[model samples]
Target: MGVFDSHKSFGKAILYTCSAESKDFFKVYESSDDKNVILSPLGVFTLLLLYAFGAEGQVADEIVEFLGAANKRHLTDSYRKLSRELSSMDPDLLAFSDNVYIDNQYSLNNSFILNAYSYNSEADIIDFRNPKSAAKTINEWVSTKTKGKINEIVSEDDITYDLVVGLYNVIFFKGHWAVPFDESETREHCFLTDDFQLIKKPMMHLLKSLDYFEDEGAGVRMIQLPYKESKFKMVVVLPSHLNGLSMVLRQISETGLLHYVNRMNHSEIVINLHLPRFEIKSEHDLKNILPKVGISSIFHGDAYGVVNEAPVSVDKAFQQAFVVVDEKGSTAGAATGLHITYTSLTPTIPFKVDRPFLFAILYDDIVLVAGTLSH
Candidate 1:
C-alpha cells in the first residue's frame, strides 16, 4: 500500500475490528474488580497481523477473518500503510515500535523476517533460558519506546521455557490540549460511580467551541477534544444514565466506534465541559480473553510456521496500558506482547463527565487506545 492508495477499505476493516475487540475486552474488565481499564487495540492488532504473516492454513484464515481483512496480503498491506502514516507524525507527539524477539535456538524463516521488517518491525534473537535478563531487555525496549510511560510490561515470571517467540508493540502519545484547560478553573466535583456512590474528584473545566453530538437512539452524548499540532484527538462517550455504560458499549460493539464518531457532524458550538482529572493503569492476560472473541486457533500449536518449523504454541499473551488526563493534556502509553502467541461527547453542551464513561484516542479514524472509567 502506498500513500496514494485509498485506505478506505483498510480503515473500515481495522475500525470494526478494533471496536468489536475493544468492547469484548472492556466487558472482561467490567467483570473484574478493576475500577478503570485501558488498552491499545492498534497495538494488539499490529502484533496479530505480524503473526498472521507467518501463519498458514486455517490458522491464517481464522486470524484474517477475525481481523475483517480480505486475506493475509490485505492485513500486511494495511498495516504497512498505517505504520508509515504514524511514523511520519511528529516524534515528540507520537511514537510506535513493533518488534519480534525469538529464542536464539530457533531460526526464523528468512521470508518471515523480511515481511516483519516491511511492517516496521525489527527481529532480534535472544536467550529465553535466562528469563530475568530477557525480561529486562524487553522491558527496557518498551520503556524506551514509550518514553518511560510504561516501565515494565513483563517480569521474570512471565518468561517461560515454552516461550519461543515474543511479538511486541508499543505506542506512546503526549499532546497538549489545543485549548488548554485553566488549572485555576479545576475544582473538586462529585462523580457518581456505577454503584451510585458519590466520590469527590478533581474536575477540569473548559468552555469552548467543540464538535459535539447527542444520540437519542444510543442514549449517549459525545465530544471531541483535539491535541495541539496533531490529528490525534480524544473522544469521550457519556451515557445518559449512570449505569447505562453497558448498553452504550453494546451499541459500539454492534455499529463500531466510527458510527458514533461520524454522527458528530454537528457544527462546533460553545459548551461547558467538566471532565475529571483521572489516571488509569491496567494489565491483562489475553490468552484467556482472545479465545472468547473467536481467535482460538493460534493458541493451539498453530503458530509454528510463522516463526520456525518447531512445534510451539503461545505460552502467554499480555498487555499493559497507562493513561493520565489532567488540566494540561493527556499522556498515554501501552505495550502489548504476544509470547509466541498470539494473540463522548460531548461536549460542551454542558457535557459533564461526572460518571462512568467510555473514552478513545484516535488518529484520523484509527482507534489507538480505548477504555472505560467507572469508579
Candidate 2:
C-alpha cells in the first residue's frame, strides 16, 4: 500500500513533488476571489509524502542521518530537548531539518572543590557518557543550543544536569481546516456560517484548464494547484464540496495520491476555492503531547531499546508551530525541539516569509512540506 493509504494525511506530501509544467496552476492562487491556488506536478508529490511521513519514524531518521557521526553527539543530545518541545505540540504532522554549530565564544570552563579548592577545564562536547556529569552538560548544552527552546535535555532527574553544546532542531505539523468549503464559483457576496451568520471573507475562484477530475464513485471533486517558484511544488486534493470534509478525509488513502496527480494533464475546468484566513501560533510544552503520539512510554520510562549499556531513552521533546493561510496563497511552518540525550531541535528556523505564495520541501519522492492561499 502507498504511504497515503494510511491514517496520515497527504496534503503536506503532494506540494513537495510538483514539476515545471504543472506549476502553472500556482498562478491561480488569489484570496481576493480573483486568483486561485495553483500547483505543479512536483509540488503535488512532495505534499503527498509530507502528509504520509511527517509523523513516521522516517523523518527522525533523515535528520539523524543528515547530521551523521560528524555531529551526532550534539544532535543526539539536542534531539532530547527538541523532542520535549515537539511532545507539547498538537499538530497532525510537521517537520523540518537544519544544521547546528557550537558557539566557541560562549564556551566557559568552571571549577569544583578539591579540599575547597579545585577546578577543571574539560572540553570536547562534554561527554554525556558520564551519566552524572553528562546529563548536566547535556541539559545546559541543549538549552544553550536552542536558546532555551528546550530546558532539560535529559530528564529522569539522574540523567540531566547543566552544560552547553550545539543542537539541530526539526519541526513537523498537520492541521485540519476548521471550516472546509467547497470549490465553486462563489458569488461576490458575504460568507456565512451554518447558522447563517454573515462574515466578510475573500473567496478564491479558478478556471483550471488541466489537472481536473470529479470522482463520482468516490463522490468528490479533485483539483491540483502548483506553485510558481519551481516545478516540484503543488497542492492537489479531493475538495469537500461533494461530501462533508470528514467523510472525504476518511475516503482518502495513500494510493489516491498518484491517481490525483498523474491523471491530470491539460483540461479546462471551473473551480471556486474558499478557505478562511487563519493565523495559528503555538508554544508547546513537551511534557503535554508526547504521550499522545506514542513516544511517552519510552521517554517517560527506563527504556528497553538498549542493551548492555546505561539506560537509553529520550528525555524531552517540545516544539512551536505556525501557519498563516489566506486567499492569495499559504505559508505553514514548524519548529520541533527535543532532547534525546542518547540523540536533536526545531524543524525550521528563522525565515523571511512574505506575500502570497506556496512552499514545500522535496527529497526524491518524499515531499515533506507544502501549503498555500496566503493572500
Candidate 3:
C-alpha cells in the first residue's frame, strides 16, 4: 500500500472518529507535566471494538456510538476487515497484533474466539489470581509482539481475581527514510520549550526534497517525511509561534488532520531540516480519558453479553508507547492493554523543530499514533 493510497477499506466515519478520539486522548494526555507524549489511538479503538463484540445492552450501545458504527455487527465486520488489511501490510514497515486473555473461571465464547482468530488474533485462558505469573506472561507476550520495545504492560498490581478478561494490542513500526539524513551534519542545538526554557540536544540536519505544506490558517508548518516503503510517513506540525502549541492543539481535529494530508504537496524542494533525535517512552491510564470521549458506560454500567455467567465492566485500561526519531529512521511500538479485574516532501523551507510540536505516524487515513513534544 502506498502512503497516499485511498482508504477505501475503512469507512469515512471510522477515520473521522478515530482521529477525533486520538485528539481527545491527546488532550487528556497533554495535561500531564511530562512534556513528551505518545499514543496509539487505532490500537486502542481496535481493542475496544473487540470488547464490543462480547458486550450487550448499554455497554454495546456506548461502544458502538463511540466507534461511530451503526451497529455491533457493522463495527465487528469493519474491524475484522481492518485487521486483515493491517496485518497484510508490509511487515518491514509495520506489524500489528492483538490477543485476548480470559480467566479460566468463565467459559469462553466460541464466537468471540473465532472472531479473534479471523482478525489474525488469538485468545488464552489464564489464572488471574496468580498475579506474579500472569503479569510475567502478559509482559512476555507484549515484549515478544513488540520486538522487545515494550514490556511490563501488566504488573502484579494490575491483576486481581475479580478480573475476568484482558485484551492486548501492539503495533510496531521501523521504516527508513526515503532520503536519509547525513550523520556528519548532526549537531548539538538548543531546543526552546513552551516555558521559554532551552535545552541543548542532538539535532539531526537533512537537506532534501520532500512533501511540505504551510498551513497559515492553523498557524503551523506541516512537513511530510516518507519512509523507504512509501506506505508510512511522519507528518510533523510545528507551530509558527514558539508558544503556540496549545493553539494548534486546540484547533486540531479530524478535519485538520485530513487537511494536512490533502494540503501536502508532492513537489520536492531543498529543505534545511533540523529535527532533534529524541526518544519518548510514555505510559497512560486511559480509564479516565475514555469517558470524556463519549465512552462512559463501560466504566460503571452493566455489560451483559461478554460471557454466559454474569455482567462485567472494564476496570483498567491503559497504553504504553515508545518512539525514537533520529537521522536514520523512526521506530515506534505501542501496547494498549485492558485488565478486566475485571477490565514529507517538505519543502526546502527551514523546518527546524526547535520547539514544542506535534507529530502523527500515519498509514493512509489511519493515525497509528499521535503525540506531542513539549520539551
Candidate 4:
C-alpha cells in the first residue's frame, strides 16, 4: 500500500514503524542505569525519507521496505504533504524542518535536489574536510530549529573525512495544557521504580475530563491530555502492576502503538490524575542500534546515488532529544543527524502514574516523541 492512500493510513504506518523502533531502542538501554529515555520517531523518519529520495539500487529498496512505502515517489510525496501540514501549524506551538549538507567535492543529483525542494528542505554545500567548522555550522542550525532545546547532535569527532552528505531533521513543540495543573497543587510524592526503589519526585495533580481507556486483557490504562488550542496531546500508558513496564512495552511492540491509541476513542471523563514533573534528555549512537532493526546496508557504502561524483556512505548517525513535562504543560524537541550516515493514560478514573510508564507526544496521528519513565 502507498503511504498517500490516506492520512490515517500514513500516520498509522509511521506510528507502527517508529513505535517498534522505539522498543528496540529501549532494549539497548535496558541494562544501563538511565531511568528515562526520549526520542523523536518523526524526526528520524523524515531524515531517512530524505536519504531514500537520493538512494538507488539495494539501498533504495531496503529503506523503502523499512519505511513501508510502495516506492520512492510515494514516500517523497507523502512526506511533502506531511511536511506542509506540520509547517502550517502555529510556529510558536510547533515547528518542523529538514536540511541536507553536501560536501563541495560532490554535487547532488538534480532529481534528488528537486525532491528535497518539494518538501521545503534546505540543501547546502559545505566543506567536509574541515570537520570542526562543518559541525559548528550544523549544530547552530539544529539549535536554532529546536529553539535551543537541543544544542548539539553532532560533534567534530562525528564528522569523518569520508562523509559526503549529512541529512538532518528537527521537530520542536511547546504547548500549554488545556487544563493546566495548578502549580500550588503540585507536591512531592513517592514514585516506585521498576526495581522497587521508592524515589520522591514532584507530582502534578489535577482532576479534569480527558480521554481514557483501560484494557483489562493488557493490564494497562491509557489517558490523553490535550494541549491548549491544538491537536497535540500527551498520551500516557500505565501498567496495572507496579513492575509491569516491560509487559506494557511488549504489548506495544506486538500489537503496535496505534492499536492501543486507537482504542482510546471511548469518551472523555473527569478523573483524578497524578503526573510527575519530569525532564529527560537523551543521546543515542544509532549505528549500533539501526542494524538490529534491519537498516544496515546504507552504512556499508551501499548509498551511492546521492552524490553525483564520488561514492559515499553513511559514516555516523546520531539523535539527541529533550523533553520537559510540568504543571503548566510540555516542551519537547529533537534533532536527528545522519553524518552521511545515517541512520497514557491515562486514565482519568483515579489515574496515578506512581510507577514506571510509557508516554508519547502526538500531533493528530503522528507521534512526535515517545519514551519511558522508570523512576
Candidate 5:
C-alpha cells in the first residue's frame, strides 16, 4: 500500500452524506478555476470529521457508513455541528473555513458509475443544482471571515445536477508568513528527504540569534522563524530527543497546532531557519486505501446502493491537493468528495498513525492555513 493511501482515502466518507450522484459533488469542486488557496464544502466537511474523533482511520469508515445510512435529521445536525468544530483552529485560520454557501435542489441522475457528467448539458445542469445551503453559506462566510486572502467560494456549477441532493461547505484561505525573511538573506540550500535524496533548492535563511530553551518535561522544542512582514511567521516545534513527532500530531489536531503555537514565549534568542520554496500537488486514489481501514463495501465491485437518481453507483473517490510555499506567502487548494458508502456500527478507538513521519502546517496568527505531511 502507498504511504498516504489510508490517510488520503479517508476523505471519501464525505460522499456518504449525499445521494448516489455524489460524483457531481466532486466535479463541482475539482472544476474550480481560481488559483488561490481553495477548498469545497465537501473537503471542509471531510476534514471536520478528522477533528471530531481520535481514530482517524476508523472514524473515517464510520463517517462513510453514517453518510450512507444515517437519517436526514442526523445529517443536518451533523453538518451544523461541523461548523462549531471548525472553531478549534487559530481564530485567523478557522476564519477562512468559510467561503461558499448553497441552498437549492436538482434532478438525481443515476445513469452509470464512474460517469458524473454523462449528459451533454451537465455543464449547465450543475449551475442550477445548488445543494448544501448551509455548507455554501459557511464557505462564503470564510471569504469575508479571512478577508480577500481566501478569495472565492464554491458555486453551484461545480456540482452536477444529476445528484438528487447534496450540501457543500467549503473554506478557502491565503496568507503570508507572520514574519518575513529578507531577500538578502535568501540563498540556495540543500533539502534532505527521508529517503536520503538531496535536492538543491532556493532556501530562505534567517540568521538572528534568540533565547532558546528545551524542557524534557514538556517533550517539545519551539523555534520561531520570522518573515519580512509582521504578519509573516514560521514556527517549528521539534520534539525532544526521545519524543516522537507522530505522538504530537496524533495528540494535536489542526486546532491543537494553534493551541501549542500560542503557548510559545518570545525571547532574544538566536534563530537559524532554513526552508525551501516548494510546491507539491498530490492526487490520492481511494481504491486500495479504503479497504485497509475497513470501509471496503462501498467501492468494491459487488457494492450496491442508490446514491444517484439512476441505478448507477460510485466506483471510486479521487482527491487532488496542491500547495505552494514561497518567501512571499503560501497558497493551497484541496478538492474532495464521496465515491461510495456502506452500513456499519462501531465506536472507534484513537488510532495513532505515528511511525517516523514529518508534518509542516501553515498558519496565519492562530489559524491553521494549511498542513503538509511526509512519511
Candidate 6:
C-alpha cells in the first residue's frame, strides 16, 4: 500500500516513534540535575530517514525499522506528501527545510538526491576537508532556512577531514496564543523545584476558558492553547505536585502520551493559568543518544548504499534547538545535522510551569518539538 493511503496510520507511527525516542532522549539528556532542554524529535527523525534512504543493507534496515516505515521509499514518499500538505500552510507558523552536502570526492545516488529535492531538500557538493569555509556555507543555509534564529548548526570544531556527507534538517515555528495573557497581569511568583528550593520568576497570568483536563491518576493536568489558525497548538502537562515532574516525565511513554492526548480531546474547563516565560537553547551530540534508541548500525558499521564505491560510516551527529515563550507568542527553531556519522509532550491544567514541567509544540497530533523545563 502507498504510504499516503495510510496517512492516518503513518502519522500515528510518526508520533509513536517520536514519543519513544523522546523518552530515551529524556533519560539520557534531561535526566541530569538542574538542566532545561528542548528537542526537535521530528527534525532528528527526518534527517535520519533521509540518510536511510541513501543507505542500504543493515543500516537501512535498522533505520527503516526504527522509523516505523515499511521501506525507505515509503518513508520518503510519506514525508514528501507531508511537506506538500505543509507547504500551503501559514509560513509564519511553520517552516521546514532539508539539505545534504556531499564532499566532491564522492558520488551520491541520484535517485536518493531526487527524493530529497522532491521534498524541497537541496543537495550541494562541497569540500569537507576545508572545514572552515564549508561550515560557514552550511551554517548560512541553516540560518536562511530558520529565518536567522538558528545561525549555526555546524562549527569549525564539528567538522573534520573524515566527514564525507552531511545531512541537515531545519524546522522553525512561531505561534501566538489564541487567548493571550495580559502583560500587566504578569508578576514575580515563587517557583518551587524538586529540591524544595524556591526562585522568583516572571509568571504570566490569564483566566480563560480553555481545553483542559486533569488526570489524577497520572498526577498531571493538561491544556491545549491554540495558535492563530488553530491548526497547531501548545499542549502543557503540569504535575499536580510542585516536585512531581520526575514522575510525570518517567511516565511519558507512547501509549501513555497517546492516552493523555485522547483523554484531553473529551475535556475542557476554565483555567487560571500561571505560566512562566522561559527560553531554552540546547545543543546535543546524538552520538551518545541515538545509539541508545536502537540506531547503532550507522555509527561504526560498514554502511553503504548512499554513495557508490566508497566505505563511509557516520562520524558525528548534532542538533541545535531554541525556544522562547513570551507575553505575545512563542518562537522555536531547531536544526539537526549528521556528518556521515549518523544519527538519529504535554499538558495543562491550572498549568503553572512555575517550577519544572514538560511542553510540546504540535501540528495537530504530530509533536514537532518537545522538552523539559527544570530551572
As for TM-score, the candidate ahead, 1 or 5, is 1
TM-score of every candidate = 0.93, 0.43, 0.92, 0.93, 0.47, 0.90
Across residues 80-142, which tens digit of lDDT does each residue of candidate 6 receive? 877776655666778887888988888787777777777777788998889899999999998
Compared with the true structure, what per-residue lDDT tens digits does model 3 show for residues 34-119? 86888887877888888777778887887777666677877776676668878987665688989888888886677667777888
Checking candidate 1 for backbone clashes, the offending pairs are 54-306, 222-344, 222-345, 222-346, 223-344, 223-345, 223-346, 236-344, 237-344, 271-348
What's the ranking of the predictions by lDDT, best on top? 1, 4, 3, 6, 5, 2
Which lDDT tens digits does candidate 4 get at residues 1-375? 223447454555577554563434455355346758887878777877888877787777777766767777777777887788887777788888889998888799887788888888999989989989998999899889888887778878878877788899889999899989999999999999878999999999999877788998889899999898567889999999888887877777666776887788555577798999999998877777777767777787455567777556677777888899998899998898887732202344798999999999987777888888887
Residue-level error in angstroms, candidate 2, position 260: 3.4
lDDT of 2: 0.34
Q: Candidate 6: how many backbone clashes? A: 13
lDDT of 5 at 16: 24
RMSD of each: 3.6, 15.5, 3.7, 3.7, 13.6, 3.7
Rate residue 245 of model 2 by lDDT: 29
Off by over 4 Å in 3: 1-23, 89-92, 342-347
Candidate 4 accuracy as TM-score: 0.93
lDDT of each: 0.80, 0.34, 0.77, 0.79, 0.38, 0.76
Instruction: List candidate 1 stretches off by more than 4 Å.
Output: 1-9, 21-23, 341-348
Off by over 4 Å in 4: 1-9, 21-33, 265-268, 341-348
lDDT of 5 at 265: 51
Winner on lDDT (2 vs 3): 3
Q: Sort all candidates by TM-score, best to worst.
A: 1, 4, 3, 6, 5, 2
- Writing each residue's lDDT as its tens digit, candidate 2 over 55-163 gives 2244433332322212323333333333333344443333333222212223321211110011011124344335666556545654543344445534445334321
Better of 4 and 6 by TM-score: 4
